[model samples]
Target chain A: MSAPFYIGYNAKMPPATAAFLRRWVVALFVAGAGVAVALAGLQHRYGDGQFEFGIVKSFDGIISESPYPNLIVRRPIGTDAKDVRSRVLLVAPGKHGAQELVRGLEGRAVTLQGSLITRDNQSMIEVRPGTIAVQAAAVAGDDGVPLGNFTLRGEIVDSKCYFGVMKPGNLKPHKACAIRCISGGCPPVLVVRDADGMAVYFVLAGSDGGAVSSDVLDKIAEPLEITGEVERQDNVLVLKAEPGTYRRLE
Target chain B: MTLAYQAISWNRQKRVYDTVMAGGVLTFLAVFVVTGLVLHSEITAEALLIRALGTGAFLLLNVVLSIGPLCRVDPRFLPMLYNRRHMGVATFLLGAAHGGFALVQFHALGDVNPLVSVLTGNTDVQRLSEFPFEWFGLFALVLLFLMAATSHDFWLANLTAPVWKALHMGVYLAYAALVLHVVLGVLQAETSPWLVGVLGLGMAWILGLHVFTGWREWCGDREHAGATADGFVEVCAVADIPENRARVVTLGGERVAVFRYDGKVSALSSVCRHQNGPLGEGCVVDGFVTCPWHGYQYLPETGASPPPFTESVPTFAVKIVMGQVWVHPRPNAPGTRVEPAKIG
Candidate 1:
């Protein structure tokens, strides 16, 4: 008896199991396809640009006009440069005296025949058909002649001043200040001296204490040919110069 | 006497069937372990599923092949062979899952037409050098699907045994294709030394078991020689027996169990038929012989019932002269022929 043999041997299984397997396979395929479709839709949406926006507001007052007599009107600072909107006023000789001209214009602008000078000792005078439209500073005066042809020097001291007072006492003492001095009634200026001990003047303009307009400030270090005469009243030094006295440095 | 009779009546068929089923289940579990550990990857999720399916299919086929040989060696393993088509269907279903996932992942989402993509998507197939290797997996998958589709008893009855057997022989082609599939697709593509070693060891184990068992059968021919007439039937001397032993003999191509115990000799059908395990290979313990395969037993003299086991083998007459043991091929009433072998 080697080993028992089974003839006609065969194997069988329940039908339900096969049906269940087929169902499971079909469900997996459906779920996988769904995910692929969802991902493709997301990719398409992000590729196109179609989103949203939001806006905001601000304010300020208009200030000075240009000084040149024959200039055409131009645009306000914030507007695009090509647009022109504002105007300038003109003044004739004898129509207004310096004090009356400076007075009637409280918030209004006026034309005056005078030079522009810094309180720290530098000066310049206007020549020929000279006129400028500006709102007068609080301490502005007729006798406060824009100084020129005067020599003065001192250690560059700090002061709060803007363009109004050129007299010594007008500047406050010992206050730390930027070159743009507001309280002293004169814009701050740099003080330099020549070898002959003559005061060489350089006017600070704007907030940065560089010299004034190039035509007037460029001859700063050398002797300047000026037509202004100095006037002293109550120990305050001021220079009164004829418009023609303004000349380039020698 | 009653106790001896009670001990010899166990059923053998059910026992053999149970063993084969258990073996098939174990093989299925073993394949699951291999696939789960080896086929993990993110991009190739579909590929992994297919590989797992292939592994499961191969395991089922291996189990099916083992069942027949195992049943012949131990009829206690036959019950497992009875319900094995379930395993085959399971393998087919798993293979389908693999194919389905591969179709959707690589083909449905691909740029080409879905059918074309499935047919040509595998780079291994497109490359000329890898053609046959890649085609082997496709062929195996198709073969498994066909077998699984026709795995019902309905098909078995309709097809006839020879035709059914012939059709099922496609499993061999499937096996060969799977071997090449693994070699080319997994081994060549993965290039992992660990995987290579594992695959090599598994193939070696299966081949080794098959070869060793086959060799053992070829070398062991222990059948008895000379037939002697006793009444109308011829008896043969199976082998020399000691005081309490037995030998298996064949008469007219029918197997019979010959036993010598308590100073007498007796014979019975080698198979219990209820499960078909060798009755002679059983031991003469407590005056009854217990089958070495599944423990079915029979009394050496009466060949009667054991409690809880009602099966019996056909009893034959036996005798011994000199040192020779002999068996009568014709069966007789259980207790009539009991010529015990001489103790030498």
Candidate 2:
């Protein structure tokens, strides 16, 4: 086998050509380095419309189901029941074993310190890692009356996009992208309608009340009939259901 | 050629090639991101970044693949083939960025492992439209990585030309994978006809180039028509070869570069010692037959590199009769001196 011809390039070339090649090399390096710097400086993380990094603000509220096992804290207006409905809750960064921590504090008022961010006019407290603390024992607050074992239907969507990243994160068109978001550990939320004919979201949980993230990977963006007991945790709604109870319609 | 191997035996050409490629990549990212933000005004910066890097790598790979066939059809494009590995390595690095960032964004912070999630997340392969296409991209990237990893001269020397060529030829398979990846991934949702059109045209162009050049070569070989008794055959008229350039012809079952230079004609084996390049396509530069592929030089009289450069090719016995060049079919020993036949 003969040695490769390109073992060396232009070993014997005219001085003029060599100079031209060298100058071209310099031009390339200058242009490349300048553009690289611009790109590096332009680096940024765009949170799905739902997340915004902000100052650490402490808030007190009752945990409620937003849809399917996600936590939304409801701040009380007064002892009167009519004013409690005016509150909203947003939770995020739900990291640091947050799925389990929020479940254990169900129906309890908790004070959490984290960056407060709003999405679609809905507020969510992005709890910093390991900053959640319970203010009192799990006690029933003046949340709205039980909405009962509502057997509602809608597609389960990953909340990351539904809340902000994508405008309409549910239905057939967004199915594959939504499924991927959920399977990657984004919280899954069930988009359904209430008896009053209002669109409501429930943070879904497994029947055993554990993180149903892995369990719902196959059910994303697919319409399903989910039967579960809905409870008001502060301002959010939580749907507790098992894998077998949810039947696929399509 | 150096006796020892460094990471890269840097040259001005290679330096220029890499620098220009780097500039292209960075400029592409800047333009893509800025335009996406301006036109759509909705896509996240991160998503634009991923798309930019992904597209950059894809386009560069296609460019790398086209360079070879392009050079075959027109020797003017041969310079693109020199230091071509720099482009391959840059493409791989860009691909790595896209793959890594995508893994973190779409696959990480989930309950399952990121890599595992990509595999298990899309079990809906039953529907052809929804079949998991990321897997194809992953496979292609792996093949590209292997090719890029072994692109250096050290590997080429160890593996030999044929083996090295075969290994790098895996780029075609990667190209196939990339085509499917695009068709199944972005094409699944993209509404633009231009993207699909560009893809179809790119594939057609590449396939057409290969077929066109292959057919041309086959026809040229079949029509040699220079089989003469006693091994001497008329390859072409002396006027057929351009001054200081070669006329490649198959005479006596050997490809020979018959050069008309300095009012004399010299016949030498057309296959370059380095990479078996078609030396016939090259031109004489500064008193040396310079291989167009990488500028490897040889003394037309001796079929050997100038002093201190040991590479040599077989010289052929040539004689001019009535302004026509006739070459003996049998090759002379490598580096053998053969007096040029003076032209009228």
Candidate 3:
């Protein structure tokens, strides 16, 4: 008998053609499943970043506006007198910094509600809108301890996203979003990894210790060598460098 | 082909094809997400969904593209081509979903409009390593949308076969953009050998299939420079074709489908008026040359669809000399009828 011909408008496919298609369709499904497993298995686990999402908690701390908004809270379990404060970076919800929220409250104690975002040792707060209230009058906070100037190589990422807003959010794939975040007032951070692949986050600041989010916009998500003065304010590190002096490393 | 266009004819075969396709897509997603959660528990739901949909769309498009060459290389694969527009439309929906999720996840909630951000987000065009790969994905998504929107026969008839075929050829361009999208985007960060190897294999498979089919077609067409007599070319013997079937011969750089049916022979343009499908590969069903790809029908003698259907292809004059079929090298205008030559 001649091979069965297939007419699509016909209600039934020829038996031979139907049988043939059944085999091929089975093979296609098997192949598709295999591809899905391979693709999913091959992905790199970028980091264990956590975004608390909607779990808002109240935090009382000294809110600083300069060099990007941050909340310096007292360590609940302080071991060393020198590290009694934990600097929790503050960002407004949705790709923005808390600068506007903390504009006039610099060095003042305040309580704010927000979700916590944490990756390794770095912590940030996605501040809830209209949640800040003055708790105490202006009080002096720690003048950052100077760590000697050093030349460091790292990739700059938006602090808001790199902390936990997104996972696998610190490389070429996340470059555009990082740029958008930084441009939209999310603080830019320089991420330097040690020889052991452990990342060290530094809040990027202009050489004179001011916000560098706008200055470092063009260099986000690229490898660069920056010669800067590093300082420790509470547990957070800040890298002070002139954006223009940063060299793009090939 | 129907005389009038409906949203969809919804035949049993089409329903089966779509069901199987949906099942395959759902299975892929279930496996990908479940396996991802097992492997990387820390992955965000949004991130997993985006990657799964994007990769799924990419793989589905690869399958959609391979179907054509697969059919050409082996006729048993014809059933896959029957409702391929269903796959095309599914691919577009998958792609649109992926793009939409990516836009919301990465670009929305930002200061600028999400659409504007997609275009202007990463101005790293100067550097190859940091090129704005999002633009490539956007380009592919737009093309897939165009193809899916016009996949129905109504558009094919209104646009004309050549114009419609040209528009659908954008699938290749979309595929190319997606290649760049994967290469410059995820691959840059993923950097896994398995990922790179699988991507290379998919590309090689597509390229190899097309090349092999093209080579076979070239070999078949090369036999055209044979003996000629009195403005006719000796194509093949009448015995070479089976009853209700055609023998395609390339004459004057055009493929002609010479059909032998009911003890008479008629020749028509081998190119189907719908999507340029090879009419010669089709069989005479109910006295009409039914396209194997989509079942678009044309009269064997006149090369025109029956009344209420306006599609037509060029016709050629044929005469049976001895037991051999001689066909004129030139073609008559589309829909022009020439009397069929008797067998004896």
Candidate 4:
């Protein structure tokens, strides 16, 4: 018998060709499933971050609107002595900071409903729309223990998403989103990692202690070396540095 | 063998082909997502979908590219080439899903428009590590869209075969762009040596298949340069061609399929009118020369499809002298009829 020839328009293929194709198709599907599992297994581990999506709770604190919008809340009765207050970062519902929400509430006592996003020691609140209630003015002090100036190397990521809005949100794949968040008034953070790969988060500020979101747009999500003064206010560590002095390490 | 364009010329083989392809795709996706969630319980839903679809499209493209060369190297692989366009369209759909999810996830909630953000997100072109890789993915998606949108036979007929073939060749460029998209974008973040090795292996497989097929064709064409006499170049002996089969010969930089069938020999242009398929690789079926790719048929003596079918290829004059087949170097206009040489 001559070799089997396939003509697609015909209702039936030659039995020999059909048998051969059936075997190959089975092999291909089996191989395809194997490749998918292998590829999935080889993926790098996802970041250990938690975004309390859709869970709202009330928080009472003093809103600060300087380098970035944040709320200062007093710690519970018995907590660590190093920091007596919890500096909770604040952001809006979307990819935006809480600047508009807390515009004139600086140094005033307020309570707001929000969802919590946290990674390690860093915490942020995505304030629900129209939920901030202004209370009586509270006494404020700008005293934070200033750590010695040191050079640190790390990548700059947007505080809102990096905290937990997105998983694995601090790399080249997430660079564009980080730029958008920072541009839209979210605080930019300098993330420095220790020798064992544990990350340390610092909210970046201008050398004169102001918001540096606009200044560090082009430098997000890259290996950058910055020499700055680190100050601890409650639980938040602020890195004061000139954006122009940030050097990109190749 | 279609006289008019239907939405599709569905057949038993095509139905079976699409079923297998769809099964493979769903199997891949199901396995990828289930395994991803099982291993990394904390991965976000959006990220999982994007990665699964993107990787699926890339692997499908590799298979799509390998089909042509596989068919060339072995005829048993010809059945896979029958409904390969369906595979191409499915690949585009998968890629579009990946791109759409990524755009919304990474760029939608931002201040600027998502499309604008994709183009202007990162401008570090001077630096290799930080170059905007989204643009590469976008470019590849556009090319795939074009190819998929015009994958039907109606567009093939309207655009003409050469133009259609040239446009579809953009798959190679799209493949290259996608390679850059993965290498520069995710690979930079996910620095796994195994991931890199798998990508490298796929590329090596595609490259090796093409090179091997091209070498085999070059050898065949070079070996059949027969002596010329009396304005006819000797192709091969009639006995050299199998019954109801063809011996492809190159003359004057053009290939001709000289077919031997039922005590006579005739030569036709090797290029199929449909998609420029290699007619020389096809076999004679039921008194008509059938294209191995899509089964487009032509008459061996006239190089034209039977009545009610308009597709045709060019014909070359052939004559037999002392058991050796000699073919004229010049080709007649497409569909031109010539006498069949009788085999003694």
- On DockQ, the candidate that comes out on top is 3
- Candidates in order, TM-scores: namely 0.37, 0.77, 0.97, 0.97
TM-score-better candidate, 2 vs 4: 4
Which regions in candidate 4 have their CA more than 4 angstroms from the true location?
Answer: A76-83
Candidate 4 lDDT over residue span B226-314, tens digit each: 78898999988898999888988888888899999989999999989888888987888899999888888999999999998888889
For model 1, fnat equals 0.02
Model 4: what TM-score?
A: 0.97
**In candidate 2, residue A14 scores what lDDT?**
45
Interface RMSD of each: 34.0, 7.9, 1.0, 1.3
Cα lDDT for residue B305, model 1? 44
**Model 1 docking grade:** incorrect
lDDT of 3 by residue, B69-114 (tens): 9998778788888888889999999899999999998999988999
- lDDT score at residue A182, model 2, on the 0-100 scale: 62
TM-score (0 to 1) of chain B for each candidate: 0.54, 0.87, 0.97, 0.98
By lDDT, the best candidate is 3
Candidate 3 chain A worst ten-residue window by lDDT: A75-84
**Predicted chain A of model 4: TM-score relative to the true chain A?**
0.93
Cα-based lDDT for every prediction:
0.43, 0.69, 0.89, 0.89
Candidate 1 per-residue lDDT over residues B1-344, each given as its tens digit: 12232212323433443454445444444444343434321112233344445555555566566655664555444444544555566666666676675454333422345455434433333443234343565687788777777665456546764676667779778877877766664454344565565456556756766676677645543444565555423343434554455666666566776777776677777665333545665667677776544345677665754655545556776656665655666676544435444545
DockQ of 4: 0.73
True contacts kept of each: 0.02, 0.09, 0.71, 0.72
Evaluate residue B288 in candidate 1 and report its C-alpha lDDT on the 0 to 100 scale.
Answer: 76
